[model samples]
Target: MITMSPASSNINSTDLDYYCTETPTVAIIWCVLGVLCACVGIPASVWLLWVLVQRQRSGTSNDIYVVNLTVMDLFYNVGTAPSMINYIAFRNHAFVLLDEILYSFSAIGRPLFMTCMCMDCFMAVVYPITYMKMKRYRYRLLSCAAVWGITPCIGTINAFIWYSPIPGALYWLLVPTIAICDLAILYTLRKPDPSGRSDVHPQKQRALQTITNSFVMTLVCYLPLMAMGPFLRLMPASDQVKFCVISLLVYIAPLLGGIIMPLLQLHSLGRLRGLLYCTRDSGSSEQPDQQL
Candidate 1:
């Protein structure tokens, strides 16, 4: 008589083989969307990082948050590669854990970094005195370092307990916090400048608008995934239908976030036109020169 090992006694080889061989529709859609987003987001993020590094100065130390956001975008977009390959090829689960861990990095990092940006803007607008006193590159760098160190631990937890709604709920909570900061900044920006410069308020208002738009982008990407998390618990672990729908949405949130984040960051920094429209202006100028 043949005997099975204790660990293998409960394992179902048929289910495992089916899972490895079958590609879900949601996963297919996810791979396609991920590829498209990576194409645009990767280049935009790299360019934005280049611009940020080139323009770095002592007074602009607050840009560390945006720089970190850009890096998160890079991780988010590029990290999809392994999952895409595995899913498209209908391969085994060898890379699934690694892919999920990579995703958790951005999933956790995005909100934390965005909260930092919101708070940075909030303090600058709402309490300039305190902001000025607290503003220091070393402090911000340390804060980012803490976040970097914390991310892997949290991400590892997330990877292990991916089915748990707790992680998703925690990140979802940041949306309201960021929205509150955006609202507070909006209220403050509306008041007349105490400095008595009417011209300055418009620029400030424009900046605030860009920041608000970024918050909106977060909502767009995050809400569906947040809403879907609870439903996951109601479904069975063996439910392929549930997996398809939830997995599509679960990954799409961060994919969309990775895609749109750099554009929003550039807009907030008043560099949107530099990325989108500056080349046209440069071309026009060169055309005139070539005619001469």
Candidate 2:
């Protein structure tokens, strides 16, 4: 069995005591949020997967990256939501290994997906001509495979290496990596369109805007968690505030990423709108309607 040292044990004790003695109102709020997240995230993620798979089959590249992003969000929601509910239900009891695994996967997967989406945006903006020339469906399939395959390995390694001895450094590294990649994506968006035109297709522009919004949403959700790490390590003994804050932020970040990001995309991307409302005589009616 994994054992805690005196200091670590004391820290855990203090944390539990804090939670037990703290305002019940805060706990109720967290529980309500947790339930709401699970209720909304679970079905939305499933729908996103169904929609993406159908679109993939029909070979629409217009929002393939968005589809991949939706899949990642699906994984996050499916993996994380129940665990959050359980944590709120159980209130700091020892979680099973399966819960640990799911929680770890969700934590790591959220950031990894954001990184992959940023990379996808970079590819779309920096290599527009190349992206247009290629067989986008095939490339998207390969890219999805790479993101799903590679992220678990990276997460596993990082978890083993950093969770115990060097939490701060690991978080520092992760934050910077996320920040840099996001900045690169932002820069890519700012560059002049190769066609030398001020205006682009509404669909294309919306797709890009969806990516931008997703990135911003991710950064906003995660910043608090990242900022909390140093404070957590430095003031490890603080009982009422630190643990509650950390737990709340950790849960909220993935909740927002999984639930909010896709909704943002659905609002921004007209393809989904078109697919959902095929009877409407919008600009979407002109295209050769692909299956789903």
The best candidate in terms of lDDT: 1
Per-residue lDDT of 134-242 in model 1, one digit per residue for the tens?
A: 8467777887897788666665665455234445666568778888888888788877868887765565866576577757866887666666655655766554444
Candidate 2 ranges with C-alpha deviation above 4 Å: 1-24, 62-69, 79-85, 88-96, 127-171, 191-196, 202-204, 235-237, 271-292
Error of 2 at 22 (Å): 5.0
Worst 10 residues of 1 by lDDT: 1-10
Q: Score residue 255 of candidate 2 by CA lDDT.
A: 58
Residue 256, model 2, lDDT:
58
Pairs clashing within candidate 2: none
Question: Cα RMSDs of all predictions?
Answer: 6.9, 8.2
lDDT of 1: 0.66
TM-score for each candidate, following the candidate numbering: 0.79, 0.68
- In angstroms, the error of model 1 at 10 is 22
| Best candidate (score: TM-score) | 1
Clash statistics: count for each candidate: 0, 0
lDDT of each: 0.66, 0.55
